[model samples]
Target: KKLDAKVKLWHHNSQGLFDYSTKDFQEYTLKWRGDAFLTKSNNRIQNQPSLPKTPIAKLKANDLALYPGHLFASLCQDLWLVARSFTNGYRLAPGDIVRLGAQAFKVKQICTDKPTNKGFSLTDLLVFQEPSGETSQVHSLPCRVCLSESYSSQNPLISPCNCKGSMKYIHLKCLQQSIKSRVHSTDYSLAFMFKNLSCELCSKQYSSKFYLNGELKDLLEIKNLPQPYVVLESLSCKEQGLYIASFCTKSILSLGRSHQSEVLIKDPSVSRNHAKLVYKGQGIYLKDNKSKYGTTILVKRPISLKENPHLEFQSENSTIQFKASGLVNLLPSCLRQPVAKGPKSPSLPLFPVNKGICLSTDDLDFLVREAQGELLNTSLSFCQDSIQNFEA
Candidate 1:
């Protein structure tokens, strides 16, 4: 609280004590490795034909000799043209002209190796002249899609899609038409909503919405109809039958009393077209379709008289219910009686009895007559024996 003072800080050196000072060191000598005269001659030869010989600062000859090709390349301009040609796998021959920067250069000589002993050998090339406007590339490249070199209205080629080289460029109109056709033709499933306009080959989707005109945009709204299996059952029939259908497989099933319906109910209450089992994406929907008696589905079981306890019955119900033991006891005595064993009928001959031989109709008739005669004789003998025994 005693005498508080506010002070400002100084930003720069007030005395200017920080100052510049010059210093020097000895000029160290480097041992020369190659002939200086040859190096000078090579440098002079590399310069432009029209320019006078100009001496540059002396560089370490030994260092330059180690990489003679690199040193020679540093002296020239437009080296990229030759580098590009080499990258493209084009073999350069003498007299081959290369165009670069609005100028044309002819390959004058191809030196396979460097003749000097002081430097490393490189594929030396001597090219002639700079770029000249007199000669130019005249031929135009064609579009891969249309295969057209030029348009009447001079429509320029563009590559909006992910394609490379010759297959890249295409006219705007051609692209639009192609997209329109693809949208109309391709079938969309449940995944259609997430799908975008894409190249069939590359699967690269179209990102630019501006490319989609009104017609194409509207076409995008058309989605593939969902196809699902359905069960069509007739409620009226005592023996209920279910039909499986789908939009993809079977289109529709008409239900009614009429024979024309795919699922005939044979119920008087049902109309000719009582209901239609329509298959939509959501699920199998039951459309009434305006029938005489409206279609209804029982959601729950109804109450019976037994459950109500109000109505009394003494064997009045059509359906009979009994316990397992009581049901067996209630069965008729005739039905419960044991089966009797009777005299066996004469057995017929086995099929194809004699290996490969099969009995004909005449043979079968003869065999039947013989068996009947023998049975009749035996019955007559038995009756006579019974009569004699009874008389005795």
Candidate 2:
């Protein structure tokens, strides 16, 4: 009788726990490293003024946080609002306790071998376990996810398809919804962490902006700003407006792509015209309010694959059609083209010839010619956004 057959372990730190607790923490207030940053963020907090200075204990459990939904827990002080620069901020020591919604982890070890002027970054590998006495994260089968290495024959994948080169496999369901199969064999996953994500529609970046709720905690990455994560949901319309997430650097936090869905981090600063949009908790949001000439559709919450948005996203077999109505005449015959973020040509080598080797100019020129071919050896493909005239 294994008392904990269905144990769920989340390998996260204090920030994850704080984010998962947004609902109750909404009223809590936050302050940025600089007062101007505060003014900017407060303006973006959407539908709210300053964050209420409240206590965590008074909040309900449901408001704490959930991995799979937009409804999360937040807190006062807005620590994460400014916790940027993973190379600095927040020093963790052994036996330190950290919380992640419904679960708390302790620092077992800090690999402090690397030396930096910032006194060894806080980005240390943290180990945690279930206080229930069930299992530790290191030894658990479900919790362990490792990167692909040279002879990983024993690595089990969610599907027959193997992982992309140099990528480690993490449980899809750990932070975001898991894909039953990796259809195209992608190099990145929703489970992995990212630093920058641009809107596929407008090529605009999703930078740190207003948080849906007030909460903050020092994070490992980025000093003096929130340890933010970008969220993209398979949402249905209803929750309107651009679903904006606030964090410094506006880099992508995570990306999730399954059979019929894909989620990404956004900066929410793109133009609102003639573009396809996706947001957190929202599945696929399309807007025709731009009168077909230049339409702007915003995705607010999760929607179904059968819905209008996923039809374009989940064309497992083919491309989906875009149906424009009242504004069709205002749009172009073929305005809804996807972005062209095709396979980029390989970059040239940094040191064409070893700098210290004392090579002649002739040798350098030869190396340059060879590198040119590498740069030209790529093709055009869909990146994400494709802006143009449209059809009604």
Candidate 3:
């Protein structure tokens, strides 16, 4: 009869229970049985699956009624309380201020552990206590680099990286000088400055820029020589840091894994002379040199089918091809509006009805004319800011 009742229960909840695997289903059944036993006896049974250490732990047998309405109604109060607790709870996040009596702390980092199948997770917080009334006036610690206690508002001491102990604190100027000594070159005209700007001990990369006395400052100062410069940040785990290559009008900057190349990538996939960046007519263009893993760019906007019927682009490991049929126009009439006469607004490539077209990585030369400025503007801005600081 008990087996028959269990079978009936399984059949009744089959729609909702079917998603669970055999193991999960068995565990859930065990949990339900354990919960029922605990509710009746108020004691844990051997080898019985435990209930969640939540308010629902004391769930009565009536709460698991066969009918949905009865079950929901019986469990409503506990569930509502749980929901309310979660909604009203405050979670500690990075940059949050936590108070402990008279002392205050600033949360620096929050590390969370992956949740278990039993719905158990652990979180750890790294925080530093803020200086209080009398402690704020003290400045006895010396800079790690210069070993001087002379700290001013302009050249204040800071602990930016994850390095602890005596190596933790250093004057901003001393730190900058130390970094400058390790720089590949001082000239910013047409050179690459590639150095791992990370703490050697902690293996933590220093912030590219930081704030000092409410003024923003660049960690690595680079003099601005001219415009039309390209900064390539290495994504390889072995090689890191910015590779700045400035270009003159009609000048070419070569990139490859070989040291002979102007911008060395140091990756196996890159050919000896993988690609070239040509600067001409107020813009920079990339030309691939028949590389093993051909050069590719991110497609920010849709390509026009009217201009190129056959389109090819790389997505991860696969090369995708899109060939448009001349039979019908997929675009609406509103999108097919004529270009305006005034100053050219940044618009998507017009996809007018035309014969079938084909596009390859070689045919994306139009991107250099249109999207290069927008793409490089952010890096250029950072470089420009560093230049200003260098000049000052």
lDDT at position 180, candidate 2 = 20
* lDDT (Cα atoms) of all candidates against the true structure: 0.30, 0.21, 0.36
Residues 109-225, model 2: lDDT tens digits = 222222222322222222211122211112223322443222221222221112333221333232122212211222222222322222223333322221112332211232211
* lDDT of model number 3: 0.36
For candidate 2, the per-residue lDDT at 186 reads 26
Query: Candidate 3, which segments miss by more than 4 Å at Cα?
Result: 1-164, 171-174, 181-219, 233-240, 316-392
Q: Supply candidate 1's per-residue lDDT for 96.
A: 32
Q: lDDT (0-100) at residue 104 of candidate 3?
A: 21
Clashing pairs in 1: 103-131, 103-132
Per-model TM-score on C-alpha atoms: 0.19, 0.15, 0.39
Q: lDDT rank, highest first? A: 3, 1, 2
Better of 2 and 3 by TM-score: 3
RMSD values, in order shown: 52.7, 27.4, 24.6
